[model samples]
Target: MAELSEQTGVAQSTIRSLIRGRLKRLDSISTGKLAQFFQCKLDELYVMKWE
Candidate 1:
């Protein structure tokens, strides 16, 4: 996580929050950074479920 954070310039806390399902919302810029770090398309960064 530290490595990824450094590589992607995204904070470790943010990544942790996202992974732990604690994030209620995430902006497009952060999402884009994560997607780029993971070498995936922006749409693949997250999935939405209707509740």
Candidate 2:
């Protein structure tokens, strides 16, 4: 997370929160940004099965 945050300039806590399912919703801009950052489809950024 620290590595990713440093590379992406997004806070590690924010990334961790998203992975932990704390941020359940995503804004359109963030969706596009994250998708491009990870080099993946927009759908991949979404929480599909919510562990």
TM agreement with the true structure for every prediction: 0.68, 0.60
* lDDT score for residue 21 of model 1: 72
> How far does residue 1 in candidate 1 sit from its true spot (Å)?
0.7
RMSD values, in order shown:
3.6, 2.8
lDDT value for model 2: 0.67
Task: Provide the clash count, candidate 1.
Answer: 0
Q: Would you list the C-alpha lDDT of every candidate in the order shown?
A: 0.75, 0.67
Q: Which pairs of residues have clashing backbones in candidate 2?
A: none
Write one digit per residue (lDDT tens) for candidate 2, span 1-51: 777776666667777777776776566666555667889864555645342
Q: Pick the candidate with the highest TM-score.
A: 1
**Residue 1 of candidate 2: its Cα lDDT?**
72
lDDT of 1 by residue, 1-51 (tens): 999898878889998988767775668888788888878864444553222
**Which consecutive 10 residues in model 1 have the weakest lDDT in total?**
42-51
